[model samples]
Each structure stands twice: as C-alpha cells, then as structure tokens.
Target chain A: MKSRVWLRWFVVTIGLAAVIHVAVVWLVPVVIMRVFMSRVAAQYGVNRVITQPLPTDLSRTVVKPSPDLLYGVCVFDVSAGPVRLSIMPPTTYWSLSLFDTNTDNFFTFNANDLKVSTADLMLGSAGDSGDAAARFPSARFVVTPHNKGVMLARLLVLDKTNMDEALAAQKSIQCNAIKRGS
Target chain B: MMTWVAKAIGVLVVAAAIAIGSAWAVLLHYPLQTDIANGSWRTSLAVGSTSADPYTRARVALTGLFALNPSEAIYFSANVDNAGRPLRTHCTYVIDGKPFVAQWWSITAYADDNFLIPNPANRFSFNMGNVPTGTDGRYRIVASSAEQTGNWLPTGTGGRGLILTLRLYNASPEILRQLSSIELPSIKLAGSCP
Candidate 1:
C-alpha cells in the first residue's frame, strides 16, 4: 500500500512539472513583448514616431542594435481606432516591419517594394469593420492580429556622407490615430 | 497525518523547481530547432516569424527582440570562428569576404551579454559602404582590441566572449532559398593570444 501511494505521488509530480514547463515556455515571449511595449508606450506615448539616435556602446535599449542603421519606432494601439502610417523612404535601403504582441513579425516591406516615393498605410484589426479601403483609397490596409503592437522603420545610413539624408527620411516618419469614419 | 502533509509539500516544491529549471535551461542553452548551420554561423528562417515554434519565439524575445522576418532580413550569428573556436575578446581576428547579394549588408560585434562592446573609437560595425575594398573587389576587416591600420572593428577591452552578427537586408530570393550553400565571411584568428 505504501509503495502504491509513493508511485501515485511521483506521477502527480511529473505531471505538474510538465504543465509548469509548458506554461513558462509559452508565456516568456508574451511577457517580454508586453514589457517592451509598455515601456515604449509610456515614454513616447502611442501612435507617435520616435526617431532613435545612432547606436553606440551606451545604447542599451535593445540588444544587438546595428550602428549602421537609424531606427524609428512607433508603439501602436488600435483598440480605440485604426492608425495611419506615412513615410517617405530614402533612396538607400529602408524597410518597415510590424510586430505583434507575441513578437511575431507579421508584415514588412522594403523600399524596393514601393512603387511611389512615399507610402501610406492603415493598420487595423478585424473588428474595425468599415470600408477603410474606400475611405482611404490611396492607403494600403494592413490588418494586424493583435490590438497593440509595434511598427519599426529601419533606414540604412551607409556612411557619414549620407547621414543627413537618412536623418531627413527618419524625421518624415509619422504615425497617427484615425478617428472612426471621416 | 503530519508526515503525509510534509511529504505532499515537498513533492510540490520539487515539481515546481524541476519545471522552472528545465524550461529556462532549454530556452537559454539549446539551439533553435530550425537553425541552419553554415560553418560556424547559424540562422533560422522562422526567426521573428509567426510560424516560429514556442521555444524559438521565447529565445528571440530574450536575446533579439524586434527582429525582422527572414523575408525582410536574414540575421546570421557566429559565436565561433572558422576553426570552430569560441571568439574571444583578447584575440585578434580577420574577417574577409566579398559583397553580399543583398541591397545592404553589415557585420556588428557584440559582447556575451548581446550588447555593443564599449570602446574608445565608438565603432561597432562595418558595412559595405564604409569598408573599403581591395583591388580584387573583396573587403577585409581586422577585429581586435588594439588599434589596427585600416578597417578596424574594436573588440573592446577585457576577455569576454564575442559574437558576430551579419545582417543581409533584402537578400536575393536565390540566396535565401540556398542559405546553407551560400558563401559567408571567413573569420580566422590572427596572432597568438596572451
């Protein structure tokens, strides 16, 4: 009888351990992203473009930051309404990437992907039911999975010679919340 | 009855410990399941993608948050050199390569904590535009703690572990499809270490 009791406890312990392991694994990314988004939104507010300076040894906001690129970050929340993003990409290599709360990069586009000089994009969710396409016919509608996320713009500053141009392009990045309807 | 209660409490504590410990170990030490190895460098196509498994997502969140999807950029990292030796800060290395088949490319060095190493020069990376190439159209970058003549990427002081990340932005489809077969920069150790 004592042996059977011990076996039962062992099985219970193993099962509980497995459950905890899976929970920790799944929750790690969600928690990390939440902290990052909260920190950025608190400092810069939502739906506003903040151009970061060139990364050096003192730049510890993120890990493995590239010194050759200028970063523009927009922490967005679309629970209230959709957000509009407009940017004039520089002639050099540039890209805009969207990451969800789970740290998944859902949508991204580079300068070569754009046919025009500027890009106008609308970020919305499925619940944002409207003819956004018809309302803003010129803008491309990008549906995000999460209500809150981040939009990162990376502009390559090849050398000191083109730093001025890159800074100008970074300043042109804009993210604003759009009111419901016209 | 008192003994049984004590035994139950012990079992719960052990289970929690085992679970948390194993989870952190796997996330921190294990390599990604989808990693593609080319020499000493490794990259994962699922990095920063929706399709990444749970472990991969967690690892990226901890080490490289806000990473771009492989479609937009491919990040290849090397903790070892060409001879399969761990990169050390005190040692000198020579990185030789040609231009990558991408719109832009760069190589940046990081310390073991995944941050830029502190150096007086304030230099942390070498890109195609900044690095001068040779007559044969190939560029060489000397990574060392001490100053070198041309194209010097400081490794900082102290003997910390070094990590090199090569970013290929807008890489050609062919290169992405054949990532394992593509040619990457060769990191060869130079001179003896102290």
Candidate 2:
C-alpha cells in the first residue's frame, strides 16, 4: 500500500510540473508585452513615434541594445482602424519592424525593403475595415495578428559626431491614424 | 488527522517548487541556439518571428524585445574563444572577420549586464561605416581592456567579462538559409587569458 502511495505521488509531481511549464510559458510573453505596451503608450501615447534618447553608456533597460544604432519606437493600436506610417529613408542604414501583441514580428521593412527612397504603409488587422487598407496601394498593406503592438525603427549612427543629423533624419519619419475614404 | 494536514502542505510545496524551478530552467536554457563558426559564435533561430516557440518568446521578452529575425539582421554573440574558453576581461582577443554579403555590418561589445561597458576611451563598437579596413580590404578588431591602435574595442578597465555582438544587416538569403556552410569571423585568444 505504501509503494502504491509513493507511485501516485511521483505521478502527481510530474503532472503538476508539466502543467506549470505550459502555464508560465504561455502567460509570461502576454503579461510582459502588456506591461511594455502600457509603458510605451503612457510615455509616447498611441499612434505616434517617439525617438528615444540615445542609450547612455551603462544605462539600458532593454536587452542588449546596440550602441552603434539609434532606435525609435511607436506603440500601434489598430482597434479603431488602420494606421498609416510614412518614412523618409535615411542615407545610412535604417529599418522598421512591427510586432504583434504576442511579441511576434508579423511584418518587417528595412532599408533594403524599400525600392523607393520613401515608404508609405497602411497597417491594420484583418478584422479591421477593408476600406482603411484600400487607401494605400495593395502592395503597401500590412496586416497585424492583433490590434495592438509596437513599431520599432532603427537607424545606424555611423559617426558619433553626426548623431544630431541622424536624429533629425529619424524625426522626419511620420506616423498617423488612417481615416477611410477621406 | 495531523498526518493528513502535513501531507496536504507537502503537496502544495512540491507544486510550487516545480512551477518556479521549471520556469527558471526554461528561462535559462530553452531558447534555440544555432552555432556558427565552430561554436565560437551563435545566434537564435527564433528571434523576432511569429513562429518562435513559447519558451523562446518568453526568454526574448525578458532579454531582448526588439531582436530582428535572421532575415532582416542576423546577430551573433560570443563569450568563448576559438579554442572554446571563456573570454575574460583581462585577456585580449583577435577577431578575424570575413567579408560578408551584407550591405552593412558591425561588431559591438557589451558587458555582462548587457549594457555598453563604460570606458574612458568612449569606444564601444566597430562598424563597417567607422572602422578602416587593411589595404587588402580585410579587417581585424582587437578586444582588450588595454588600448590598441587600430579597430580597438575596449572591454572597460573594470575587467569584467564581456559579450561581443555581431550584426549583419540586410544579409543575403543564401547566407541565412545556410548559416553553417558560410564563413563567419573567428574570435581567437590572443596572448594569455588569466
């Protein structure tokens, strides 16, 4: 009888471990993403891009930020409708990527992603009104997996002396809400 | 009975232990790591993509939130040398890099805290845009706490261990499709690593 009881306890431990693994694994990303999104929204507001100050040395809250690169961020919300993004491609290296609420990068556009010097994109969810996406050429339409997330834009600063110029170029990039058929 | 109460507490303690222990283990070891250049350098196969596994997403969220997938940019990090030893702050290293099919590339060093190491030199990274190549178009970067002449990346005077991050932006699809077959840089131990 004692042996049977030990066997049951062992099985119970293994089963509970598996359950815990799945729960934490699935929940951490969601919770972290939500907290991050809330912070960005509070700091920059929604549907806008805020170019952060260059990461100071020995000061980084984000993971392993590249010191040579200048990063700008926008928290996107597509619940009301699609959002429009316009960027003047820098002469130097630059890229823009969109991440869904689940922290998955659904769409990414880089300096190479641009055949033109300037890129205009309309991003929305599949559930959003089709007319909002129709304003832009179909080729420039990107659909997110969810209505809320982040858009991260990175511009490489080649010379430390020319950082101000790079920030000016980064400021030229525009983001705004999309109004359908207006 | 007193025995029954003790058994119930035991079960709860066991469950809590399992939950926290497994979470920590997954956080430390669950991300997919692909070795490059004889395991001297490595990158994640799951970063910045929709298809990343749950553990990878969790780990990335904790460590690196904005990591681009291999296609946009492939980031390789190294803490070991060509002979497979931990890189110490006191030790100097020779990074022999190959010309890649990328439009732009760079190598930056970060301390153990994942922040740029504060050095009096104010030199944190070496990129194609800034560093000058040898007459033959080949380049070499020195990783040391002491000052070196060309392509010097200071690991800081504090002499803490550091990680080197190599970014290849706009890499050709062929390279990403077959990372193992291609040639990456080598970080070999220079002098003594005591």
Candidate 3:
C-alpha cells in the first residue's frame, strides 16, 4: 500500500514540473507576438496624426501616394461582361486601374488617361465633377467572347497618415462582372 | 515506523527541489532579448518618421535578442533608418512535411517603411512561387536589394531599406504549441548596399 502511494506522488511531481516547463516556453512567445502586433497598430495610428490635410491632387507630390504602401493587389479577369469597380472612402489613399486583355497594359487610372483627365466628368463641360466614375458613362468597358478575360487591378494604397483607415477600407473593396439576362 | 516516515519526508523534499530547478532552467532558456544588436533578429526597418506607438518603442528599445515564434505568422512594418541608409535583406526558411497547413509559405519584400518597392516590371514580390521545390516539396526564399534572376526582391536603391514579411499561414496548431521544435527561416545581412 505504501509503495503504491509513493508511486502516485512521484507521478504527480513529474506532471507539475512538465506543466511549468511547457508554460514557460509557450507563454513567452504568445506575449512576444502580442507585443509585436500591438506595436504595429500603435505605429500606424501615430502616422495618421502627422499628415492631417491630404493633397487633393496627388499627381504633383514627390510620393504620389505620400507614403506608398501597397498591401495586396490582385488582378481579376472576367469574360463576356462588364466589370464593376467599387471604392470605399476614409482611406489615406485609394485607386484602381483597368487592363486590356489582349495587350496586358494599364488602360486608365480613375477613368482617365494622360490626354484626358476624367476628373471633370461630373462637372460636365465645366470639368468640376464630384465622382469621376459616375460622371463618364463611357468609362465602363464591356467584354465580349473574343475579349474574354478582361482584367482589373485593385490598388489599396495606404500611407502613414491613414494606416488604420486604409486597413479598415480593405473590407469595402469588391468587384462584380455584370452579365446579360433574359 | 517513525524512521520510515522521516525517510519519506526527505524524499519529498528532494523531489520538490528538483521540480523547482527544472522550471528555473526552462525559463532561463526562454526567447528573451535586451537589444537589437546582441543577436536580436531584425524583422523590419523604420525611416523618415519613427513610430509613436509604445509597442514600437519597445521593439526599437530591444534592438537585440528578438526571438520569433517559428510556427506562427509574424508581421513587420519597416522604413529607411536614415534619408539614404541602405538596408540589406536575406533569409532562409524551411517547411515541414505531413498534412500540415503551412507545408508551403511565402516571404515578400516591401520598400523602406512597408511600401511595395517601385519596380518598372511590377515585380515587387518574391516568394516560394518563384522557387521550384524538389520532389521532397520543401521551399525557400532569398530577399535582397540587389537585382537577381531567381527569387530576388529589389530594395529600390542602396540608399533606402526594405521591409520583409514571413507568412506561415494555416500552420499546425499542435506543433506551434512547441515553438522550439519547429524550424523557422534565418534572416540576416547578406551584404551592404552600394
């Protein structure tokens, strides 16, 4: 009986020691990772303060996007339909471009080329439009069977001024290719 | 009877001491670092403007001895240290076999302070996608500022630095419970910028 009791005690002691060993190894890393992520969040938050008023026309800035940080840009190609490009505001910087399927070249940034700036579409002949995409009806492109696999690249530009806002805007960007119905 | 009891007590004391000693030893081996220079891995760079976050302050404070959790995904935001301080990048990562989620993963490069490097080719990312694995199915990525044909990510120029991210998604939760056993990539300075 006494021997059995001693054996049980031995097992308990070993188990306790093992628990402590695993905790030290595992808990340290969890703490460290948290520290790293929290630091990033804080850093991004501070960056928003220094850059208050963003440039209305970013074309002239040394850094077009100020602090150009492109997180993820995926090119989605669709066939036999019109692709819809959507944008959500509260972003430090945001833009999208359309690419031709045949040549694989960028067609336009915000519905305009260098020769014609689409920024004026909403204002009519006055060139004082509010939304570039909504103003120009010709901005939307239709792909036929021959032009299958037309592509669009969504650019998620985040600068120091609006890191959190940009990160949040990620969920808002979506794309849908329109098809003909009966 | 009294002698037997005394002997049992003595054994218990020894056992308790051993347990405490073991715990102390394991804790001592924990991934703890004081500063970045004393072997703390450089996860990312910062330039132009420093972070105002307390966590960033702590990271910058501990410039050495940052032990990474190999099984989990780690993220970093970097920037050039100085106006034209060139930052070099290099890493060698390994993946395990089995039905593990992250049997394959990637390491991408961003310019100083976490922006995509402006390359005319639009080839800013470098990862396992470029490196063809052997029959064994293991992968590796080499990040650098220099222009190389295979798995090379440019740092824009020698003047500014770049940020590197190592992502091990869908990792085995079980293996991650034991960080030391899992193998991780080794990031170091390959050379200085021109």
Best by DockQ: 1
Chain B, candidate 1: TM? 0.92
TM-score of each: 0.94, 0.89, 0.31
Evaluate residue B187 in candidate 2 and report its C-alpha lDDT on the 0 to 100 scale. 88
Ranking by DockQ: 1, 2, 3
Residue-level lDDT of model 1, residues A51-125, one tens digit each, is 988888888987788999899999998887889988888888888889998889999877666877888888998
lDDT, candidate 3, residue B186? 43
Give the per-residue lDDT of model 1 (tens digit) for B1-194.
99989988888899989999998889766676798999878999989998989988988887788899898889999989999899998899999988988889999999988899999899999998899999998999999999999999999999989999999988999989988888999999998866
lDDT of 2 by residue, B8-68 (tens): 6787678768887879776754435432443677777687778888877887687667788
Measured by lDDT, the strongest candidate is: 1
Question: Which has the better TM-score: candidate 1, or candidate 3?
Answer: 1
Off-target runs (Cα >4 Å) in candidate 3 are A1-182, B1-73, B76-104, B127-130, B188-194
Sort all candidates by lDDT, best to worst. 1, 2, 3
List candidate 2 stretches off by more than 4 Å. A127-129, A133-139, A160-165, A179-182, B1-6, B29-37
Q: Write the per-residue lDDT of candidate 3 for residues A1-182, one digit (tens) a residue.
A: 98998897778666665665555444443354344334543554211111222222222211212222333222332333234444454322233433222212223233222233222111111121223234335444422222322122222232244556655544444454334320
* Stretch of 10 with least lDDT, candidate 3 chain A: A119-128
Candidate 1: which docking quality band? medium
lDDT scores of the candidates, listed in order: 0.89, 0.78, 0.36
What number of clashing residue pairs does each candidate have, in the order they appear? 0, 0, 15
Candidate 1's C-alpha lDDT?
0.89
